[model samples]
Target: MAGEQKRFARFFFYLRNLREAALHTGARAEEAEDRGLELLHSAETEAELKKLEEADSDTLSYVKRGLNRIAFGAVNDAVKLVFDADNMTARDIMGMDLFNVSEIKISGKNVLEIKFFDRQKALEKLGELAPQLDGGGESKRLIESIYGRDGDSL
Candidate 1:
C-alpha cells in the first residue's frame, strides 16, 4: 500500500510540473502575439513587416527549444522564469531612455525618422561623414557588413 501511495505522489508531481510548463508556454505565446500584432500595425512598409516576421520565426524556434527542455525536466526552477516579462520582455527591446530620444516619426513607407535630444550635437559629429551619407559605396558596404542579408549579425 505504501509503495502504491508513493507512486501516486510521484505521478501527481510530474503532472503539476507539466501543467506549469503549459501555462508558461501559453503566457509567452499570448505576449508574443500581442507584441507582434502591434509591430505589424506600426509597420509602414512591407519590408518592415517582413523583418518582424523573420524575428518572430527566430524567437519561436528558441522558445520551442526552451520549452522542450522544460518538458524533459532538465530545467531548474531559477531558469523557469528566464522569459519573465520583468526580467526580459519585448518591451525591453524598445526601452530606450526617453531623454535621449527626442522624437520617433514615420516619415514614409520603410522609413522611420528618429530625432535625438542632442540633434545639433549629433549632426555636428556626423558632419565629417555627411558626404558619405549621399549613397557612397563605402557607406553602403559598411552598413551591409554590419547588418547581413537578413539584418542578422554576420
Candidate 2:
C-alpha cells in the first residue's frame, strides 16, 4: 500500500509538471504568433507591397533594364541619335494608348512597361531583342502547340 501510494504521488507530480510546462509553451506560442501577425500588418506600405508583388509575379523590371541598356548601346553605335544623356532613364509605360515609347515610374522604378506601336513591328523587335516580353506572339504559338487545335485549354 505504501509503494502504491508513492507511485501515485510521483505520477501526479510528473503530470502536474507536464501540464504546467505545456500551458507555458502554448502561451508563448500564442504570443509569438500575435507578434508575427502584428509585424505583417506593420509591413503594409505601397513600396513594400510593390516589392512583394514583384517578387511573386512577373514584373519584368530586370528584363526592361537589360532591353533599355541594349537599345541605348545600339543607338549609340548605329546612328547618332541625340539624347539628353544626363536625363536618360527607363520608366514604365502606364498604358499603351497609341504611344510609341511611354513611361510610367512606380516607386522610383518601372515594373510593367510596353514599348510598341504595331503588332508586327513589336513582334519583330521583341523577337530580336526582348524575347521575354513577346508574350502575345510566342505564347500563342506555345499554347496552340500544347493545347491543340481547339485552343480552348489555353
Candidate 3:
C-alpha cells in the first residue's frame, strides 16, 4: 500500500516537472535547451515535490492544486495497473504530464497555442519534445543561445 502511494506521488511529481518544463519551453524558445536541462534537474520524488508545491500555496494558484489533485487521484496504484490503462482518465494524462501531451488529439496544428509563466523553460521543452520545429530560424536562435557558439549547453 505504501509503495503504491509513493508511486502515485512520484507520478504526480513527474507530471508537475514535465508540465513546468513544457510551459517553460513554450515561453522561452530563445533559450530552449537550458530550460530543458532545468526541467531535468527539477524532477524529484512525488511526495517531496508534492510537499514543495503545498508549501508554496501562496505563490501558485489554488486551481493548480485542484488540477494536481485531480490528476494524482486518477493514477493511484500505477505499479499494479497495466501501463496502457494510465491514459484512461484526464487526471492520469494531466498528472503524468507527458504521456499524451503532444500526441493529444487536436483538430488542427496551425493554431495550437499554450502559454506559460516562464517562456524560456517552455521554449526548451518545445525544442526537446517537438523536434520538427528545431531546424527553423527560431530553432537556430535557440541552438545558438544554448550552444552560445562560444558558450555551452548544461
lDDT of each: 0.39, 0.36, 0.42
- In model 3, which range of ten residues has the least summed lDDT? 97-106
Clashes of 2: 1
Give model 2's TM-score versus the native structure: 0.19
The segments of candidate 2 whose C-alpha lies over 4 angstroms from its true place after superposition are: 1-61, 72-125, 128-131, 134-154
Over 1-154, each residue of candidate 1 has an lDDT whose tens digit, in order, gives 3332333233223332332333333324336335333332342323443543455354433433333333343222223233342455556533322323446565566454554345345445445444443335566666778897544674
Instruction: State the TM-score for model 3.
Output: 0.19
Tell how far residue 76 is off in model 2, in angstroms. Answer: 11
Best by TM-score: 1
Better of 1 and 3 by TM-score: 1
Better of 1 and 2 by lDDT: 1
Residue-wise lDDT of candidate 2 within 3-88, one digit each (tens)? 33333233222222222222222324336334333323342322444454455355553444334333321121111112232333
Indicate the residue-level lDDT of 119 in model 2.
Answer: 39
Ranking by lDDT: 3, 1, 2
